[model samples]
Target: MSDLILHHYPMSPFAEKIRAVLGYKQLAYQSVLMPRVMPKPELQALTGGYRRAPVLQIGADVYCDTALICDVLEHRASTPTLYPPAVKGATRIIAQWADTSLFWAAMAYNLSPKGAAALFAGTPEAVAKAFVQDRAAMAVGMTRLRPGDATAAYRSYLRRLANMLSDQPYLLGDAPSLADFSAYHPLWFSRVINPVMADILDATPGLLPWMDSIAAFGHGRPAELSPLDAIAVAAANTPAPLADEPFVDEHGIPLGSRVTVTPEIFGHEATEGELLAATRMHYTLRRQDERAGTLHVHFPRIGYVLRKAEG
Candidate 1:
């Protein structure tokens, strides 16, 4: 198997989710740090235009979105499974909610005036402004929860999580599942990234111990890889062959058509390519770049929009 190369930065909550999963599975991987802001030139070479943090690169195959990455990882390493059979359906649903609703509310609260100041403390004013503007551009069409509303919603969500943890060590059962990993990242950001805003967690005492247990699954051993070197690896390798599954086309677009795929909400940059595979769960695009050669970019079916490319 090729090295599980994860392109991510330290502060990405979604990246933290994948890192924790790697740790739980005891898998070793290579880490490629990516820019937190825009103009990720090397990564864009591999992904075409799907610019988001924490892309998983296995040779020439690039897996975007943590949800799809989780599935890929589960396929690679199944022991201490993320999707426990009994709660697989519920686990996936909960994970989706945590990745979207809970994530936004927590981020809104964490990036409030007080929180942002603490977050960017001692950083140059220009750098801080750039970060804010970059995020604003990504959030163009979506509505963000106001800080006050976010605080209220975050508090309520925390309490609900506490209720879920009151009985069991993990959210679904005795062993950690997708639900636990999904729910932990936002709180991980609150508690780890911006400790000043983490006072909110004090209201839900039950969550603290659960968090400690999850945190204990330290990120697995990671050797650093240069971005350019990672790109070269992709250029040298061909993407693995796609499964022989029939296309499940919800859109009028056909398998060989030129198409674009973008996240439906935040980070909506579209990636244009020839549609290669549209399985029940994901969409794959075969795109080429001078630096990265041929690559198959994969995105989860949910939370993403796929459309025919305009001439």
Candidate 2:
């Protein structure tokens, strides 16, 4: 198996979720730190424009979106299983909700006036402005929860989580499942990354202790690898064989056609490649980059829109 190379920065909450999963599984991986903002040329080279952070690179295959990344990781390490069989359906649904609704609400509150002030207290004004602008650009068409509304919703959500945890150690059952990781990351930003904004958590009892339990699974052992080196690694190797799943094409598109996959909501960058596989769960596109060689980029079917590339 090729080295598990994770491209991420320290402060990405979704990246934290993957890191924690790696830690829980005790998987050793190579780390490639990405820029906090855009113009991620090296990443774009591999992804063909899909700019999401914490992309999992295994040889020449790149996995985007944490939802699909979680699935890939689960395949790699199954024991401390993220999807327990009994509640698998519930777990996935809850994880989806947490990743979208809970995440945005928590972020809006965490980056409120007071919270943002504390977060960038010592940083230059321009740095803060750039981040805001970058995020605003990503959030162009989406409706964001206002800070006050987010606070209300976040508080309610925390209380509900407290209720869920009152009886069990994890969200679904005795063990931590995908739902816990999904829920933990947003709150992690509030508590771990920007502690000043964590006051929102104070009102909910038992929530902090649950977060502490999740945090104990520190990021697994990581060896740093430079971006150039990571790209060279991709260039040196061919994409591994894909899973043996029958193509489940819903679109009238066929394999070998050129297609573009774009996220339906935020970060609407489009990635164009030759359609390689359209399995029930994911889409695989084969694209070539000068620096990275031929690469296979994969995205989950749920959140992305696939269209045959315009001629």
Regions more than 4 Å wrong, model 2: none
Worst lDDT window (10 residues) for model 2? 201-210
lDDT score for residue 78 of model 1: 95
lDDT of residue 155 for candidate 1: 99
Winning model by TM-score? 1
Clash number for candidate 2: 0
lDDT of 2 by residue, 168-212 (tens): 989888999999999999999998899998888888768887888
Q: Which residue pairs does candidate 1 place in steric collision?
A: none
**Model 1 lDDT per residue over 147-215, tens place:** 999999999999999999999999999999999999999999999999999999998989999999999
